[model samples]
Target chain A: MKLRESVIDKSIVQNFLVDAVRKFSPYCPGDLSMATPLIRTGIVDSLTIMEVTKYIESCINTSLPVAKINRESFRTLEALSDMLFDFIKEHNLDLDIDGLKGMG
Target chain B: MDNLGQVLERSINLYPDDVALICSGEQVTYAQLGERVAQFASYFSGLGLNKGDSVAIASFKSIDVVSVMQAALRVDLVYVSLDPRFPPERLKELIRDAAVSVVVLDEFLSQEWSKLEFLPDCIQYALTLHDEKKLEIKSDVKCHNFKEINSDSNDYKRFVPQRKGEDLAYLLYTSGSTGKPKGVRITHDNALAFVEWAASEFEFSQDEHFLNHAQLSFDLSVLDLYNAFLAGARVTLLPEDDAMFFSYVVNLIRDDQITNLYMVPSGIIGLMDKGALMKEAMPKLKRILFAGEKFPVTRLKALLDWVEPNQEVYNLYGPIETNVCTFSKIKTDIVFRSECPIGEAISNAQVALRQDNGIISYDGEGEIVVSGRCVSPGYLNSPILNKSKFFLQDNHRWYCTGDYGYFDKNKVLWLKGRKDNLIKIRGYRIELDEIESHVQDTELVDDVVAVFHGSNSESGAIVLWCVFNQQALDSYGSIDIVVNLIRQKLKSVLPHFMLPKLIKSVKELPKTNRGKVDRLKLKERGI
Candidate 1:
């Protein structure tokens, strides 16, 4: 079923964000958590960030702010989730709830 | 200076205290670099690797990896660079094809160690670049840490090794349409042809600090590494993992005071799109070079505006088979409407367009052929391909570039389109069949056709249309789920850039009248 971007639970969105990094990252030195450094450790680059962004946009059925694709938003899983949640709250766009469940 | 070994030794003698390499804010002087290269060369000789033997270097970008490359050249050993980002299976295939004797791997690749089972049976040893580490592998290949040589006290006095110019220097593997990687064999003379011409033509001196934006595996790095030593100049190494980050790239260029920058156009395009690159940001960047893929004219125009009047932009063009045979200094008044001119052939080479009916024309539209010291002998271990792609005509052997282009009245080259499905995404050469071959290996699909969408710009993407087999049909619930599952599976097996941007389920892919998968039609249908 369809859902408003704001209707999604915060923790669920965070889980999705974490899941995206874990699924796409080539190197996860440790069990990746919300605090794992994505940019500083050189685990994710700009291109990998784009893949993670695309996967999130694929699940949400919407494109993200071009600004959100920067290194700051991708600093960590926590940072990415925080940025996506705030952007979702601001936009309040439509999302395919099932699509979120289907992806990593 | 008949060989690169002489280039290194001469550079060390002439510029002992000058900076040779820089990475991560650490500068390595030519003397220090010479000592490391000599140590590696002596250690490799101790390992019994003869002059003609081929060693494979598989590592992430680092100063040590560059050292190993120079050492291999010092001892007159042929070396091939293996991208650590490639799938382990693909790595094995390349190793087996090249008959790689030993693999110099990065610590990142050795994290889980050889448990990935990527090393082929032919590899006699695996050299991991870490101080102290353990590798877990079931194979008989001996594993050792690189520090074993670096930390040892056995001092072997460095000496120059005189090697023949016709001997093999390195093997570069490119995506072959035949569903396998083809190794292009380059010799010392072939490499010197480009380096000597480039160093003098570009006026590289001890003062020029170069930036290596491409991986060592890519031929684009040839200019980055060789030209520096030839000119007794300094070159900065950019780590492969950090090549995509805007801040890392800009900070390195600004702080390092990089003067000569060589990279694919898409890299700068991405930075410019984010509004990060300013004319004043890199004041020391004097020579801006782009190669590997076409730089869209619109972005090229923007780049011209972004760089100061003193800074020069150049378009360096060549396939891997011919290492940069032609180059053009870009200007505000460009002749081509949508693309930059490839310029006339360099001083060391000649370029001719050959028609299908055995006619070689210097001006008209046809497959571009390069002949001279710049032309590689042929693909290693592929005699059939060597015969077909390279030919002896008019007392010169020419390597036919699969690209169809023409020479204008000014004798400048303009790219029309590819005569094959080979595509370059962000300057990485990829074959449509390469992705399809891997997808077929998954055994989940009855058929698959991969098509490239968009220009070679940042917007470029690969899309795959797959027909599920009976096994997949019974195992999967929906097309969406199946597509997602395939993507996750492919992620572990294909290089990141080669991964399909999208996948779709199909009962059957549409075909053209020739009963071949209609790539053009499918590409148009892709997002």
Candidate 2:
């Protein structure tokens, strides 16, 4: 069931983020484009950020590096997706995008 | 010693070598802090800023930020803090509303307000700090690097200005039901009266260390910062980035040897539940203070059980206008009701139930009013509001808190919720009427009703029900898009916490017999 790092693209990670953000942050705009600012627009607050990060930890089955949580990594959907993609690549996960998405 | 500046001077003379501030693991001594305060005081004095002029800064806790606040006090300028997380337009509006002459802005928050677009004519100076970037302010306002003010120092004449007790110390803005935020003005006498009482009552001293959990704009920070300074105690400034991270906050408390913790119940609730309170043990923390909202009983009991026998817990109560008029130190063995009493009034304050213009005694439940040294001067530029919110009775001014509460036979006060549409979420006050009014200003909707969803404020989110004017769904194609557009419109006017969680488009909002929107009905009939 292991998937190579190359199999996961930036778009897939972005889509995952969009879905995660929508689930936790109800006020988020429906049309979340790649350049949409997450924290600046008040769409994703500290509480929502916590939910999103916890979701990522659960999906990865490991603790996300607590120190890696910074403002730049969450500037926009594109940036957040890149961070997730990099996390997957760095970890060399045994699952692909769908596996990351889980059964929900 | 006429003011808080004298208090700082006294502390410096008493313990020059003692650490006064701890931020990012760097320690600042009392003498060093005294020099920073004097440097800024001399600079501000050199400028033509009136003694009572306002200084606006971002509400981030840091060594320099605290120093600037002290310097303002030293020169008798009123201090104010604007949360940088708020939208640029809103921040600009606050600056204009308060008539701020000087602003200390963080360079990293450029995205939020780098280009305030148009500077209000009242602004005379802006200090760009927190980073190396010389962030450009595209305005006629004189901009300077905050760091350079220290380096470009001239002969610093150290002197504390003489100020009457009634001179304004700071202005804290809270959500107003009248569709705009109102500034609560605190004078030195108003603040010092409370600080002196609380520091002595709570026993804050040189050995104790308090954590700056509340935002600088919040009144809670007054309790932490002022008390520490008055007692020659140390304060650990929590960085904005690590604020919500419970693990990090708990770790900081343990690592920094923080002895005192004061925060809203919501923050403490999160820290207790998610932060793993027992791990990286904080034995140095001796006193825990909670305020702003009610703490759930079960979680509170668990927290009380977890702490050591020496650690004391207290529930402090007050609105922004009255800084902690009442507090209850919880006794672990006392059996509980569904709610705990808010305790008796602090020294220099009198608490009672009031009806009409008269004060009522222990039995009757009416609007909670406090008359004493802790009362704010009044709202800024709000004569009509000042007339209604504050009143002279029995030759003493009393601030009407608008909260309905009664005292039991034990002389303990219990809260009975607010009489207005104001609500608190994570200690940030939101006026539901303000949201509805702003949404109506857009004119895209025929009517908008804002209601809280969920059982209580601790777990609830704001929901807006709107009836579009015409062709709204057709133009937007979907309800989601319509809601998004409305939210996008609202971001510029309101703070992030005040934004509605969900927006629903309905043909007509339900109304009561009086022809007013039935908010209770809307809250009951959830989407």
Go through the candidates in order and give each one's DockQ.
0.20, 0.33
Output the lDDT of residue B358, model 1: 77
Write model 2 residue lDDT over B1-527, tens digit each, in one string. 34755666777888888889888777798888888777777778777888899999874667888888888888889988878777677777788889999888775564345645787889898777676766577788887776666544422245657775889888998888888899999888888888888877888878889999888888888878888887889888886656767767877788778899999888887777666676346878888999987887887888888777788899999999998999898988856677777889999798878876475555668899889988988999899999988888777788889898987778788888888888888888888999999888877799998888875555689999999877777877787777667888887688878888778878898999999888888888886
Tell me the tens digit of each residue's lDDT in model 1 across B1-527.
67766666778888989999987667788888887887777768777876778889978777778888888887778889988767676778888999888888777667645566545778887788863765556688887776764544223245456675888889999887777888999988999899888977888878988988888999989989888887889988887655766656776678778898888888887667643676766989888899989888877887887777788889999999988988999876666566788888999999999998978999889998999998999998999999999999999999989888998887888888888888998788988887788778778899998888886647667888899877776778666666766776666556667777677777888899999888888777766
Off by over 4 Å in 2: A1-6, A22-43, A58-83, A86-104, B110-114, B131-135, B150-157, B356-359, B456-458, B471-478
- The pairs that clash in candidate 1 are none
CA shift of B187, model 1, Å:
0.8
Candidate models: Cα lDDT each? 0.79, 0.79
For every model in order, what is the number of clashing pairs? 0, 0
For all candidates listed, what's the TM-score of chain B alone? 0.94, 0.95
lDDT of 2 at B354: 87
Cα DockQ of the candidate 1 complex: 0.20
